[model samples]
Target: MSDPGLPPLSRQHDRRLRQMYRSAGWPCQDTVEIELLAAGLLERRLEPSGREYLRVTDLGIARLAQALDRNRAALDAHEALVLRVAEEAQRAGRIAYRGLGLLAKPGERWLQLRPDVYSIRNTSVEDYLEPVVHEIKVRRADLLSDLKKPDKRAGYLALAGECYYVLQQGIAEPEEIPPECGVMIASASRIEVARLAPKRPMKPGFATWMVLAKAAPCRQPLEPEPRL
Candidate 1:
């Protein structure tokens, strides 16, 4: 529970924090964008140092003053939503996360990456486990925008680990005691445990072969040319 005197994380606070980060001139510009959107501030462009950008808006400074007076407990409570949902999903035999997604690659590099709520379920079939993919989307009524994106989800999935559950939340009223929320689930998939196991050291001959492979590219093409 938040302190009685503490204020909630309003969109106003979000804008203020963003202004703070921007004025500081951090190299990673998206950090400010992510923080602002996560806090539900006015949606802005992903660009850095826009032509109309101001060091700090009058409204932003006022909000920051109010935030400084409030207890920090509210901020901690709000961020815990991610771990809380993951724990609940784990109890139900599902892997869940708040804002992790997947990325897909074209050729050797990823073309797009998307981030959202992701979950996976393990399915058993004749002693084998397969992973089922799930995606969660959040849409706020006031904003009329769906926060879910495929690239984000793809990026999360591309990572080495697997997650089996997801919960999406959209806050309609930033000032309300409990912000409005929504959730969705992805269909479950079986997980392959054997593949995740660490591999044993190879014999000398195999080790030597592996060293050779690493030292030089394969003589033949890895893939056939695509048909026109």
Candidate 2:
């Protein structure tokens, strides 16, 4: 299959991903398992909402046919973490939190934006759902004193917007930083549009889906005529 130019599906092992997906299904929370299962990528028997815990089906070999190489590798690394964060957040019962490696669009480009860690909480659901976005810079205590320049802030925000990320978390913690550029969580929940930081200039790459929206037909192609 041709490269979708998209990131890998499962960065960590499959077991970890399943655990996170299952945890997201708790009461009054949103989870991606339903959508993924609907895509036939996951198989499971979910208890009725507010009932028993659901069972997850092991990934079938057939799935490998469609998964990208990066996605497979991601499952080993960041993808697993995405699930871990979701589960941990839900478990902690925190009202606000950060999500990494989620799909977002800035201008035309569809790049992966991973936040170091983001936290959000509000007095009520209404406030939590407001549309807003913000760019954050994490700094070490030593560097924090000197690196408050406007250019740095702008640079970080620009990078965030380019990746369609409204939130940024810079963990200068000696141990928290990863060796690579970064890792983004595959799926996450958005609190509210009003909560995301104000709109900024978008970068060019893959056009934002909204701009590209059109009345295109969704149909399967017909097979070519068989040789006589």
lDDT of 1 by residue, 1-228 (tens): 223444455654455565555664333355544544344433343346463332444554555666655535444533444344444445556544444323345246664332233333433332222222333222242223333433433443443233222322333322321111222322223211211211222112233234323442112213457899
Query: In model 1, where do residues sit more than 4 Å from their true spots?
Result: 1-60, 67-78, 94-103, 106-148, 153-228
Q: lDDT tens string, model 2, 1-228? A: 113553344523344344545574332223444444444445544565636443433443344433455355534544344334434434434322343333343345444453433322223553342221222322233235424433433333444332112112343432332221122222244222212233444332233223223222112224479999
Best by lDDT: 1
RMSD of each: 17.8, 23.0
Best prediction by TM-score: 1
- Structural similarity to truth (TM-score) of each candidate: 0.32, 0.22
Backbone clashes under 3 angstroms, per model: 32, 35
- The deviation in Å at residue 119 for candidate 2 is 4.3
Model 2 stretches astray by more than 4 angstroms: 1-71, 96-119, 125-228
